[model samples]
Target: MKKILILMLMAASFAAHADSFVKGADVGWLPQMEATGYKFRNAQGKEEDCLQILKDLGINTIRLRTWVNPSDDSASGHNSKDETVAMAVRAQKMGMRVMLNFHYSDSWADPQQQRKPAAWANHDFPQLLKDVYSYTYDVMQAMKQAGVTPEWVQVGNETRTGMIYPEGHTDNWPQLAQLINQGYDAIKAVSPASKVVLHLDRGHDNKWFRTWFDNAKAHGARYDVIGLSYYPYWLDGRPDYTLSINDLAANMNDMAARYGKEVMVVEVGGEDSQPQNTYDMLMAVQQKVRAVPDHKGLGVIYWEPQGARSWSHYELSAWGADGRPTKAMEAFRAR
Candidate 1:
């Protein structure tokens, strides 16, 4: 009887997640934005909850990032674990699934800068690993207590050269792997159902991903999903050049075939002024991702769909000068 019940529960879990296409938005700074008196509006210019605005446009998932110990002002420091929980609770209440992104830094932890948290600045390799695990576990526990079960958890955000600074740089692949695995272990221990995502900055550069993942895999790092950040405008005029929709699709399909793991464009955005172009680009991204074999492409997430009203000062968001979502949001329903 016990075995039968266990199997039934497992089946139920699978059923709940089967064939899910995550139309997600990353509002990691929403708390900060709201605290600073930012308000959102719908097409009618009527005030609306930011989450409601996204849901109305077909977004089903919320991706939020947490900071270890942000020392910025109250609004800026809202990325803390406790603060993340509060935001996640709100998103969950709207029937939205959560994707907890751990930046692993006090401020921004991205490819260009992965500074060691001030508290761990002097820690040795082993101690740093422990800190990573502890921070991840504590945050997951907090979210659980808040009744927010993250559907996906990112170990590190835009970890192109790895996280936690020089110690985990590309040359120190082993150290990076250890840090990532520690985070992965903590999330699985606390929320086994949550998928772990290893994120990087470039969605079109398959070679960069191959080399990074190969190194991580060699060092025993494990993850269930590969998260990519694609910002075409930023890539323009770069040596490698930006990808068209077809290029993005090819790269994503290749990654799926090569790694055999599900993937998501965990971060994507374009110039807010070019809403029509933004809509077309995102529409292409969606269709291409869905074309991956066996549906390995989970979905694309707009980094900050709440830019109107000048929240966060992001110029690439899908919001308009009128404090309403632009045509860029139509990509989700473009099919």
Candidate 2:
């Protein structure tokens, strides 16, 4: 009896010292805006209503994407700068920390497409970097002015390729690092305490991360956190939850140790298109990550949970269409 009691006490003690990590969600640009009755979703839900749902699910952070000019029909009408700021304010009022994602384009900026902003279409390399810095600073200052200082800032979204288009490609990490540093400097200039995250995809590819981060470090790019995007369906042939989770935890630890910075699974989600499997995979990943040494595991943020609302113009698959607790959410909480 004494032996069992002592073992239980030890377990409790270890749990207390383990790093407290955040479980977050990105509301996606359009749906969130529509939820505010800004554009679509005529009878929009109140911001507090959505936040209350998240809070009930134990989510602590909110990520909002900002576009330069979303009014152009040729581009996907995502949240404009003002819309993003409004969301940030609402999130702050709900007691959620905000993560600002700079798309740096009038539309979606991802590995496949990174269309440059209209005003920056003709700017040269030096001028482009200047614009990046100024835009970043101005956004940060605006958020601060609204009393919604972002807790974290992503310089660019899914920048496995790069942002600002032709000049900021990943292969040219040297020049890209300089542009990223300019943004980092601007963030620090406005909010010295805010953490600047350099985001990338291909989280399972350890070699890709090693090479990319090593180059960024060598180029003296300053950033406070390392962010990764892990989508099992897209990367791995099928949803192999266990293997992907183990790989992600190991990769996160390896990168944190190698780069000497806290690592965040900034973006992670299973295909809502395959709800059951997606939930299972996400849960598996969360459980595996929880077992990793506390110091190395930052937290996991679901890319979008309420995507089924049909507000997003991207036509991506959503897991919440059935109005059920996704396996991913169940698995995440289980961890």
Candidate 3:
């Protein structure tokens, strides 16, 4: 009995050590932009040094989003694939792991919008699947050539409504699974060590998670991680932050246990323009995430701190107008 107790104690210590090493942030584009003078510092003189600042705050990973083609004119606009690979390379140089989020479109791809890339619009469903596979493979190859192999690859972003939509809807699990599998296969072909993540919105809804994942499994969609997007104001109408965080963490733990996969709060953040209440909620959520078991919970990622009203020309701001680290960022550190 004494020997068994000793073994258990050692196992517990190992688990704690593992958990302590996994804190991360999704600040991929921020750092690269910091070099270009897109500031995010506050009045305290905390400069918008994304990578260095995140490293100082215990962040070990970075996530970047990639789009197929980002401009309607095609003459001058952001080249998402190139920019993402550049960011990944820089992150790796900073000793942080990279997770590439493929939007599979020219612009933003989310639950409400899954606009097909112009090149793939003419293709039928089967042809589109092939295009997905080929595009994924080509991108992986390009990243590898650039010496920036990602640690994780997301087939699509916030795909609860399904990606490349009209055909890849949630109800068409079998076809969607095949498309996802193609992406997985492409990633494995280059970086076999990389993990494949299946991302979805609606982190607070446990029933939605269960149904979605169960259906994916039934369709033979193999994935290494379950990614969730949690936005308090949008997801929960009342905006009760504490309850929402607790609920999300609990649901994540439950889903991990059921699916035998690690959980990632892949996209999570509140409007920086909001008061201390929003910050408090974010911190509470981080605390709850940290308390989860190491084998189940991986980490939480803050979506886009620089995209806030203070820094960008884009309206519908998510960040504050001051270009400083909001209460939400401090909450991210759980300090």
Candidate 4:
């Protein structure tokens, strides 16, 4: 009886030290994977679902991207509202937290492009805000009906400038804040506990984040979390970042102190050439996040570690050519 009690106490202590850190992955390609003849193999070389493989890696959260009525065969079309709910239900069944990413576009939305959905292309800024609010509310309502409440809802994906292009850009900060507030309010009305994230790429630049958030705060934009995208391999190529990994960690710390909001690496990837290097990058990012004052740095997420050379044509996947995840994924192991 004494031994059992000791073991129970140890488990509880470990849980308390861990503090609900999120090790997440964005597998937006899951449905399309099912459509193809591909199979994700586990460490034991047995055919397994991609998500199950991720769960085995100790990934506690799943992030899925959704589009605004994309046409069939488009990248965004594969991840419709039904697909988002399906993905969320699968993650929830595995006892994993979920993050819903609303791209607010019919196609890919990123720092380089933020096209207004064709259906709303003609709408003025005021009408656009209403559309954004309705779309966000509707998605949350559907997820709730499916018995899945997202732990986080991203208002937009990689919005370095502003969303909806010509209509709403950095030049017009007030309109941008209004549009973001609409989405923030919608998510709150549906799932009060679900934290809203304002996402941007470039995880290493402190100056850009300060400027952006300063503008956001002044214009009445509110959010619970700050989402960053860090691609170590792609960092040097971008003139704006040009930062080393150490710089990335410093940026995270500065964000926590400056914004007083939780920070997360919503998207990250490493080169597959050296699994150890990938592992190091993951650990490096995780350490910076966990080191944030007051535990506001949430965690790091691998963007598409399973996509590989499959349908996504993404080369940064941690999976080996032999159909198994490399040892790098073991970086997710609690230290």
Candidate 5:
């Protein structure tokens, strides 16, 4: 009888999670932007807390990236463990769900570069695995201490070619899977309720996702969510969302069906210069994600939508030069 009750409670928890559609944004740059006097304004051009402005725009989830032993560079650094915990606590205080992205490096970890942190650079393969687990566990423990339990946790950032390179590159699937599992296990150890995400870039490319995930599965990579980064403007030769929207929808559907896991556009954005087009693109992207059967399509998250171009000089942000959110952000209001 006790065992039956425990199973029912677990099922209820999962049902609650599935029913919540996440409208999120990765605002890892918020702290630095604010520190440098970057202001965020609502529709009326009135200064407001950035998170409050985002929450008003229907963002229920906030994603922040953490780097290992990062510098204090305004643009390239400052996502250290303590700062991340502080940010997570702030977001949670505002009644927002948190998603922590572990970059596993002292800097960016993307498809083009996945350098190991200087501290871990000298570690052997086995030590590297232990480093991954220990770092992940420590940060997660910090969040727990700060009263922030992230709803989702990414093992690595945009690891299309794999992460912690040299040893954990995609070419070395066995080692890569070990590194991934170390993070996964550590996350579960700290926050068992948090869904672990294995992220990749190019959400519309079905072939690449199939190849990568198939390898992960064969090598026993454990994760509950498949995270994708969709940037229409970044696609070569197909720089328009119209050209790839359908493809992204198809890929999301296929990922859910093939891997039997929840799918999320963990990162997405449009050109800030084209507000209307970006707004339309965002609406269409959300539509496609919601269209996925069985609610397997978790939701879409705009990457740094509030990282105004004037401050970050990032073209894909959804903020204007005047420190106000562009019309593109209104797409989230539909949620």
Candidate 6:
């Protein structure tokens, strides 16, 4: 009993030390933007490496998304495994931690659509399970070989309804659990220290989160982190952060207590046109996550903060029209 106690205490100490607030950004569109000659400037109005600009803004972590057999289109393609490994190595060399998001699709996978990759379209249920495990392990192993392991690996991106469509859909809870577990097991196999995240959309919807997580528990889904995407601009009736900030905080607290898991606002952003409002929103969100009991709140990440609206036509980016980051980026520095 004494030996077991010592081991447990050591584990707790390690976990405590490892629990640092993660300030991150998902710059999945960065590589494409750069290739197309989209340059980024620092506050000083001088051209700088985009990663350095992010680092200067106090970003300690970088999130990259990977797709399977993507097309070569500039808008929707080129997050292949090779590119992901290269990006991971680059971010690690810049003294930043990395988070890998697996979309498990050829394009974006989210609440509206979770289409299977074309190669996976005709696969049977059993084969799809193997595919998930094999593909996940392959990318993880590539990262390992490249000398940069991610701190967090997401099994799927914004999978509110579920991923891989009908086969792994929430309609069949058992199968969805199995698919998630396959990715979880594969990630652990390659990088045992890495935390596996199960991500979903709509961070402020407590009732939906509870029901989804309850079903996850009942069906035996495994994940170390409960990742959420909190986008006020996208919310139907509630278009302001103030309207949902309290609910987001409560949901974070409730998820940590109920599931015994760490929670992270893995994806968040405000309108670039409203820099001050976006900055305020970011500050508020950070405070709420930091307030989670026992340091269970991992962190918040801005999705595509550097993807300027002029280039990507995305409104939620933190970058200004002139290629410099907007005031919203300062919130990370404030901490």
RMSD of each: 5.3, 4.5, 3.6, 3.4, 4.6, 4.4
Shift of residue 178 alpha carbon in model 6, Å: 0.5
Error of 3 at 269 (Å): 0.7
What are the per-residue Cα lDDT tens digits for candidate 2 across 1-335? 99999999988876764425667788755354444553211112323355556655667788888888787442256578788888888888888889999889988889899888999999999999999999999999999899988888989888877778799987787788888988999999999999999888978888878888888888888998888888776765745655566677778788877888877888887666566777676666666555555455667788766565444433223334433334445555554
**Predicted structure 2: clash tally:** 3
Model 3 ranges with Cα > 4 A deviation: 1-22, 27-37, 42-48, 72-79, 313-320
- Score every model by TM-score: 0.91, 0.85, 0.86, 0.93, 0.94, 0.94
Pairs of residues at least 3 apart in sequence or in different chains that clash in candidate 2: 272-319, 279-327, 279-328
Worst 10 residues of 5 by lDDT: 13-22
Error of 3 at 51 (Å): 2.3
Write candidate 5's Cα lDDT for 143-249 as tens digits. 99998999999999999999999899999999999999999999999899999999999999999999999999999999999999999999997878999999999
Off by over 4 Å in 4: 1-14, 17-19, 74-76, 238-243
lDDT of 4 by residue, 189-270 (tens): 9999999999888878778888899999899999999999998677657422224667777877888888788999999888
Over the stretch 203-297, how does candidate 6's per-residue lDDT look in tens digits?
99999999999999999999999999999998887778999999999999999999999999999999999999999999999999989998899
lDDT against the true structure, per candidate, is 0.85, 0.74, 0.74, 0.85, 0.94, 0.94
Misplaced by over 4 Å in model 5 are: 1-19
Q: Which digits, one per residue and each the tens of the lDDT, describe model 1 over residues 1-335?
A: 99999999988865654437888898876776777777788978999998998998989999998988886574356688877899899999999999999988898889778988899999999999899999999999999888889999999889998889888887888888989999999999999999999999878887888898888878999899999888888786642223455667777888888888998999998888888888878887787777888868898899888856365567888998788899989887644
Error of 1 at 264 (Å): 0.7
